[model samples]
Target: MPVVFIHGVATRAGEQYQRGVAAREELIRRLLVDRMAASDPRWAGMQVVSPYWGDLAVRHYWAQATLPPVGTLEDMGVGDDGVAAADLEVADLVKEIGNDATGLEALGAETPLRNAWSKNPHRTVEALLAPIVHSDRSVLRPQDLGITEQARPAQALGEIDGRVLAAGSLAASDEAVGAAIRDALSDDAALTVITDAIVARTEQVAPVEASTDSALESLGPGWLDTLRDRVGEVLNRAKSAPARVATLAALDRYRDGLHGHLTLFMGDVFVYLLRRGEAGSPGPIVERVREAIADAPRSRADEPLIVLTHSMGGNIFYDLVTTYEPSLKVDLWVSAGGQVGQFEEMKLFKASTVVDPPAPPMPPKVAALGGRVRTWLNIYDPADILSFLVEPVFTDPDAGVRIKDLKFKSGVSALKAHGAYYSRPTFYELLGREFGSRP
Candidate 1:
């Protein structure tokens, strides 16, 4: 089975603000693809597809404008407090026009023509030229198009964390340290000895002086105590040499695990769409996944399907499998920082009328998929605030395999939350158990 990758909200192609940003995103994609190909020779045959879906751009002007919001058809005119009834009506009409254009796009119209028609040029031109002195201006200048900066790459990638590391400049010292660690791991020393060496080296590097001594001095004695406490916490955590070694090993495995044309499917929370009860309605999202999966090169049909989904992506996968090939087996389904067990809260059927008539539920656990789903592993980071603390609401622990939740002291960062599992070594180790054995 071919793996399919999906990006989270507000991250899509042709939706960038700056051309430079788009280049960077393309760079990230290249890096990921290259890294995966290098991990396994088979990965060279893997097909990678990034579907481009436009995201809504929220602007201050849109928030402050005297127009009714876009989603509703209600009419409210321009006013000091809010849009007037007439303005609201105009906004609604504009939205209707945009929707019509979107419908055309869905039916295969090119983007430029779709966007042009969607703008309702007559109304927009009237509004813009209204300030001009000319009573009859037939020609509109290109500058009058009111084009703003497109979305940028920085907005899509967000910030980096331990897992979702960005391809950018790093602190020279940090780079050197990381390089040294990698070098040490490359040696065939026993895991224990290698770990001890790393720990000793880390301890030898004394803490650097704060850049702002004056700022430190301004703090009371209590501040120093707090700083000391934090330092102690770090030292204490460092003492767990065995665990740290395991973590390093895991990271190495993850790095080594990407082989053949692997597809990484990322999941997000229900909050992505902000739909109150639509988290479980897989219809809205599954079609994209199917399309992506179908687009992958079929040369490596026997290659294992490696799926890593977080939060709502879990349910989305369920819908995909059930709808397309309920009998289709997968190599692995890794759920990290997910809420898959909370099927009741998910209310999968209640969100959409189409989903209301539920299909016969599959066995609650991952094992029940039999040969169809080889292994379903759920990994949780203790520091992830959004993840469920307990097992999912589903029954049959055997069907759904649970692993020791890997605890990273740094916790999950903004870019790392939900989608970071694929980037982490621990995640790679789990994948290695299935895919890495070939090499």
Candidate 2:
């Protein structure tokens, strides 16, 4: 059977190849296997395929920037030391700049890889944009969109830490370091807006001499020239301000767009998915998905197309399948924490004949999906803010699209619930029963 997993944002090209991606797939395999009584063989050989579309967004912005690749901080001689020094620089900046004490406090409380976000996302945004404020207009321009990348604030802070490290002055005030970076990155239009807002608040903007004195001698002459050339390349990007505005808007669409930068679960997936066009906004990624899953083997007659989707992934598939409509028949659709429930109400999907009270569930003997699918199950955590009852919108007894909604109550908090359904045992058990692999 074709077991396709549609992933949400963040799983960018490089990111999808990381350890966490492998771990999730491994766990899914284990979950499928564990559902059987150690005797079933049907699901034993099943493989899960997750198509990563995160690179689309990165590709979209990079196409416009047209600058050469940015070598790592390690190559620049800044190295991994920036991670440790970044904390120190942040403390200094917070104390000196008087940016956002609440956001800083939240950052301190947050876990690693998840620290830069605040309880108030908008306020945190302000703090991140505070340092670059200058005159009526901030020194940071829309062109700086490229600098936000995967981790905007944290990455921006680390970039400043690199300058501090190269300066050979661990003792330099956070204010001085921020100012130095602002000046050095001035021509580099790809600079992050959050970084500027943060650095601008520092009391003093240090001159290049103040930070680069000793390091400049060891670095030789061409390094500064290369930096200048890169700056020019960044500024010369042909795309106008509208592109930048669209990019920022894209950043705000998925998971309220917070997952792209703040959360570990998502990345730049929305950046490309949100690019609008005459045809459709997600037309690009949707086409890419069609190509990836086009070759699933049809070796077994009993096997039907099986789709497991979560969060934004479900939305993507819903659009794809809905567009194809009655022509597309998914044998089994396993949706968790998805927005599939709202499609009809949003006018994205038109209801068929307004079947008064939704047709109630039928017996197993009645068959499902017009005898095409064994079941259509949706498992979700009640606390997950993203989850909703699909029965109201998806149930169509006439079309044989039966939606069975089940709640998984294991979540400790609303925020934590969105990602927990994947590992929920009840979810796996339901899958096993529906597949008839277990008693």
Candidate 3:
């Protein structure tokens, strides 16, 4: 089988882009190609072709002049000169804990699908970390647990320290930690234990409190008390202000990401829309995809063609196959986190000639693809703002076009969901089961 993957927008040409392409190729090799080969050797040599279009992406002439400055921690009213470092440390720790908690929640929720997708403990743990990290939970507190700080910190610290050490060991290789996470996901008892430990560590045995205690124990309460008195309440602000830190930090991050990413996103989309020339004179990006599809290798004289597109790539291909090359063969066209339906609804794409349903006939372009493209699987995430349902957009039953709109939980929030699809093994697993096993 020959697979062509057209990437989404905001993809700039760099080592990161190269890695993404390579990673997708490997994912297909392991999840789809390798599995298909197990059933039939003919698919043993499945070829994956990922074309680059990021180089032609939107560019800002004025650079920073056009974009507003991203606010620093100081600008967010985080200035206690003496404890600036401590405040940053607390903020970072709180963010990490929040992310871990969210990951644990996603794993717990998706246990069945995760287990079905992969048996490897390492892969399982990796799947846990696959979700987007944008959690902003309130700071875990000892009072909430109905325990005094003194009663739990000692024992809890030991247990939590052990878990941390185990996590740290995996940190060096990164693989070890993911395996532990995956193992924890499989067992509820284990997951609960990990969750409690994390909560305890965050609330009872926080580094801020630990350091304060250490100072008091070594230098005597008198000296520390004197120092605290000198610094006044500001000395304790970082410890008591984690909620503020986490909130402000999350806001800042969201603001920065939205501004930066939205620019390139809109830029690339507009660039493609404005520049995509007429049928005979296709744009550079369109030509790149067309050439890639044409050059895609087939194992046999007649192998089924699979074209997988993400984000704007889906829109580009939708126009390409519909108007430019109406007879192009696409056995399986999977549009994950795409806006093909939305663009058509907005009358943006070149092939948007169809009147909405109740008016019998489907759009010429859509009906054309319905006949040629054997399977039009539209995988979308409810959490993703960018992902839209095609079935609702193009609902012409007589057209013989059935676009499967699958609800895949790609990420936890809008910030992460759009980009989270490709990172998920579960996504690949679904693809493998859906079309990889077909004859």
In terms of TM-score, the best-performing candidate is 3
- Give the least accurate 10-residue stretch of model 2, judged by summed lDDT: 129-138
In model 3, the worst 10-residue window by lDDT is 131-140
Question: How accurate locally, in lDDT, is each candidate?
Answer: 0.34, 0.42, 0.55
Q: Put down candidate 3 lDDT per residue, 295-383, tens digits, no spaces.
A: 87777866678888999999989999887778797777889999998887677877766466635564443443646677789999897
Q: What clash count does candidate 1 reach? A: 28
- TM-scores of the models, in the given order? 0.39, 0.45, 0.62
Per-residue lDDT of model 1, residues 1-439, tens digit only: 4445443333334322222232222322233333455775544444333333223212234433443323322222112321121222222233344245432232232222123222433222122111110111111111222222322222222211110111111111233433443344321221222233323332332121232111112222332223223223322222231122221232222222122101112212333233322324434355566666655554464565656555555555655564444555566565656554454444552321233444557323222233455566665665565455323333334545433333332122332344444433233433444444311
Clashes of each: 28, 11, 1
Q: What ranking emerges by lDDT with the best candidate at the front?
A: 3, 2, 1
Cα displacement (angstroms), candidate 2, residue 49, comes to 1.0
lDDT tens digits by residue: candidate 2, 282-328 = 35677666655676554356645778888777766665664433345
What does the lDDT read for residue 196 in candidate 2? 38
Q: Distance (Å) between predicted and true CA of 55, model 2?
A: 1.3
